[model samples]
Target: MTTVRIPAGWPATEEQARAVQDELRERVVTDEPGPPPRTGQVTGVDVAYDDERDVVVAAAVVLDAADLTVVAEATAVGTVSFPYVPGLLAFREIPTVLAALDALPCRPGLVVCDGYGLAHPRRFGLASHLGVLTGLPTIGVAKNPFTFTYDDPGIPRGSVSPLRADADEVGRALRTREGVKPVFVSVGHRVTLDNACAHALALTPEYRLPETTRRADALCRRALREATA
Candidate 1:
């Protein structure tokens, strides 16, 4: 696998991080609502890192978005090249994710990521990185906001919030299931935020995260754990 160096201590200087983020914001593709998405399969992609072995594990899990059942699952492993910078997360995880996608037995209609989408500082988070790299439609569902801020819309589930980077509304924060924490939803590529949020909601019935992320995250952890065990 190809590699890119992360800075010595991992995280970047605040200034350097901000610069990269500003560059990303300039490249945002903010068009209006488009055509409807076809009813099709959706996949979840996630990564778990093991610093001791300098390894990254990726998982891709496809599911029936309408029914929330697994269709296919794949896992891949690779080295971590980049350091863990706050905003520049895509560079570190995407390589392994591609490997995970390559191992998939079936192609998914779309991908839901456990990271950022347009909610990123550059407006291109993990979903955007993976989508463009693989040319697949993707959305990001993150547990926390990186550089974006918004109201939490209270709890009780299904509460919605608009994510703002500075002052611009980039995406929406969605609660997947009742009593579950909200996941930030944004358009990563070839999709709209609304569509992405709808897809995420359709794939969830239990837990805080959508089934794809929940399962894929588990798969990635298992892959790394079993390998090092």
Candidate 2:
């Protein structure tokens, strides 16, 4: 795997966040109707933090895109080099995610992350950051919205609401399973908004979260647990 360089000195500050957002928006594809994806295999990425150490423990879980079953897993450990800024979380985890993805024996068709995407204040969340760095089709599915606003989908699972920023549609807040909280779905890169939702929905199997995310979350916890043990 090729090493993707992280742009040094990214503003972890609010001013920097805005600047980077503009840069990212200009760099990212916002054109209508992206090209059809020809590849397969969807991967889920999740992070478990060691609060005391301020370290990021993460996992990447690859699944059969058609069947949504786990096929491979990779783990990574790294420091949160960036601060916990509201819209700049991609800086905190992109390196660790790249490390973990690099360790995977096989490449993935799509990557779904536990964060926001085009719905971000700067439109460059973790998903977009990693997607741009890796040139991968990625989606951001967050349990909660960051700065974007929309009507709640309510308690019923499978309900959805549009995530709008500045009175424009950025993404969707989807309820995957009943009674569980909804997740915000947004396009990261090289993927359409509808395709992002399709990938997320296809990975669900009687769970509030996608199969990939569930697997990665469990893997992340296991990594943290084993490392601490």
Off by over 4 Å in 2: 1-21, 30-39, 153-158
Native RMSD of candidate 1 (Å): 4.1
lDDT (Cα, tens digit) per residue for candidate 1, span 1-229: 2222343553245566556545644544435342244366888898888898898888889887667778999887787857887767877887678877887778876888988877876566788767666767778888887768888766756678898887888888787666556788888877877777777666666677888888898988998898668
Candidate 2, residues 78-171, lDDT tens digits: the string is 7666777777787777777888898898986688899887888767788887777787878888888777788878667667889989788889
Instruction: Highest lDDT: give the candidate number.
Output: 2
Work out the TM-score per prediction. Answer: 0.83, 0.86
lDDT of each: 0.75, 0.77
Which 10-residue window of candidate 2 scores lowest in summed lDDT? 30-39
- Pairs of residues at least 3 apart in sequence or in different chains that clash in candidate 1: 6-83, 24-122, 25-122
> What pairs collide in candidate 2?
none
Measured with C-alpha atoms, the lDDT of residue 209 in candidate 1 is: 81
RMSD for all candidates, in order, please. Answer: 4.1, 3.3
